[model samples]
Target: MKLSRFGGILSAFTATMALGLSGAGAATAATPQARATGYVALGDSYSAGVGAGSYDSASGSCKRSTKAYPALWAAANSVSSFTFSACSGARTGDVLSKQLGALNSSTGLVSITVGGNDAGFADTMKVCATDTESACLTRVAQARTYIQGTLPGKLDQVYNAISGKAAAARVVVLGYPHIYKLGGTCIGLSEKVRTAINAAADDINTVTAKRAADHGFAFGDVNTTFAGHELCSGSPWLHSITLPVDESYHPTAAGQSGGYLPVLRSAA
Candidate 1:
């Protein structure tokens, strides 16, 4: 595992927040409710809101987007304190070593979207997009094997640590959406490759959902939330091949707000 490289419409985007990440500070008000809840967001690029634009420059390569769900939630709900520790290219070990320090007894809520990097999600997509169909399937099959065999234990370890440090926190674990719309008329790649890529997403969600339940944490299934909005669906919230290489395959700001936000909202 390694930290690797990893949005939306104009009118739909939220104003960027001055995220105080990996440190303690009072968040700007967006709600009238008492901002007493301590919230710490942790996980991979998805959690850090990479695909979504308006990233906080302070996050540097981590690309912590102000449009990310954690920042959006904190703003809308008026949390007392917020910490954005999820980083781009983060793996399970990275979560344990880098992100977990923000958690404590005072933490009221936690949310994460990890395990993709461990499964080589970004690399897998790269192979599928640029390489041959057979090569794409091979890479996907490899990811599936790793997802099924090794990812569970790594996830368990992270979940256990989250609970250990933030005993009373309501942890919400979010999963990825299928990148492509199945059986659609997307050019370049065949349906078989598209389906395989989606299957990888499903595998990750299945394992992640089970492990989240095992730890008494809520699993937010974004597939259902992202239904009819995949790449070939004509109204994709998730991005396809795009500029700034890392943004590819990740959700647009529209996906973050319209797709991921509601899922995290109801789950949290």
Candidate 2:
């Protein structure tokens, strides 16, 4: 009788301890990540979801796609407010003037994929696609030069602006993926061209990452997720000299859903 009572008490105590620990663990996990109530998507074509299709007519010339990573994240999280202000051909100045309007003290989250357009990504791809490897390398070299010299200051301005606008927001600066798979078959460009293109992407990402870190923002690099999925991998996530002219060399719908979405999710 006495022994039974003791065992019952012991079991009850153990169960209570377990529940207490479980509650603490839950709290620890939940408290670290601030709830993102309001989100603003900023930056250029990648952020606008240009090549992913499903364009929102309201976005007009911006070519904002409903399938972009920012949209996917907002839909998944069901944030209180989401502003998709990213445009197709935006540069640092564009973000400063047009996109910053969406940010405020109440903004809880921000995501951007800029610096690419500023680094002349579109023209670099155009050169790589239509010109010889020598020309491609030259264009890529110029882009890298811009990235090394001028991009840091531009990024600093934008990051500071974002921080100033959304004081408490958790900013996640997403990056672009390598366009081609080196050593793989290219319809027009060669392996050397692909390598140079990928190298330029690396340079931009490195610079962007440094700037993001300087501003205490998270840099969501999609390159790792995009590996084995670059164009000429037999399963490509990006477009190749695509139609509509604007879609060329951009991520396809699959790229947004599979590549970019996961990176932002993990960072955000």
Candidate 3:
């Protein structure tokens, strides 16, 4: 959903009509109410909408897209203000140093998708996709070790920082979708490799969900939402591969709208 600047004007008008405010009172009435529902989005490439395309030029290399789930959700909802701070290639440390500034006590809603980068998911997938199955499995093993061991503490740091900054906001930690169709096969990637990658995705989701719960944030589980639309499915939601490589394995625009947006909306 591409939101125009006029969308805010229309929202203000609608709010005025809803309140039955007329004359001078109508102008002042809608502004404050709209501004009160502040929303901030923070995380990595997944949150920044890397594979969805139509990247926001003003957002620079961060590649924030209007088609991204967070932007779509913001456009569809009646929020007073929204800040999208997610950037491509962002790790937990990047978020701590850069994104958390967008959050504050007045923030009403927050959403994030992270930890894959920390677990070296892209590198692991590269090995699996371009190298031997044995090598890929070895990489997967390394990723799982990192996910189970080091990733949790890093996730907790980011989660705690988010909770601290947006004390009053409802934080929604989103999980990554599986890269392969369950019990299915695709070109280039063997079933065994696919299973291993999916298992890694599961590990990331499991830890993310538990950490979110510990921090008292809602975990938006997209696994079931993406059930029949994995990378190798007849109609896949996620992009299997792309020209730039960085775009590979990310959710497509349709995936952002149909897969992630609805789940996040429900949680919000």
TM-score of each: 0.86, 0.86, 0.86
lDDT by residue (1-268, candidate 3, tens digit) is 3477689889998988877757557677756543337899999999999999999999999999999999999998888789999999999999999998878777999999999999998899888888899999999999999999999999999998987877888999999998899674578888888889899999999999999999999999898788899977899988877877899999999899988898899998
Off by over 4 Å in 2: 1-36
Steric clash pairs (candidate 1):
4-89, 6-246, 7-252, 7-253, 8-253
Poorest lDDT segment (10 consecutive residues) of candidate 2: 184-193
For residues 17-132, write the lDDT of model 1, one tens digit per residue: 22333122343343344423789999999989989999899999999999998899989986768999999999999999999997887788999999999999999999988999
lDDT of model 1 at residue 188? 79
lDDT per residue, candidate 2, 217-263, as tens digits? 99999998999899888899998876899898899999999999999
Question: How many collisions between residues are there in candidate 3?
Answer: 1
Off by over 4 Å in 3: 1-36
List of clashing residue pairs for candidate 2: none
Candidate 1's TM-score: 0.86
Judge candidate 3 at residue 121 and give its lDDT: 83
Best by lDDT: 2
Please give the ranking of all candidate structures by lDDT, highest first, separated by commas.
2, 3, 1
Worst 10 residues of 1 by lDDT: 1-10
Candidate models: Cα lDDT each: 0.90, 0.91, 0.90
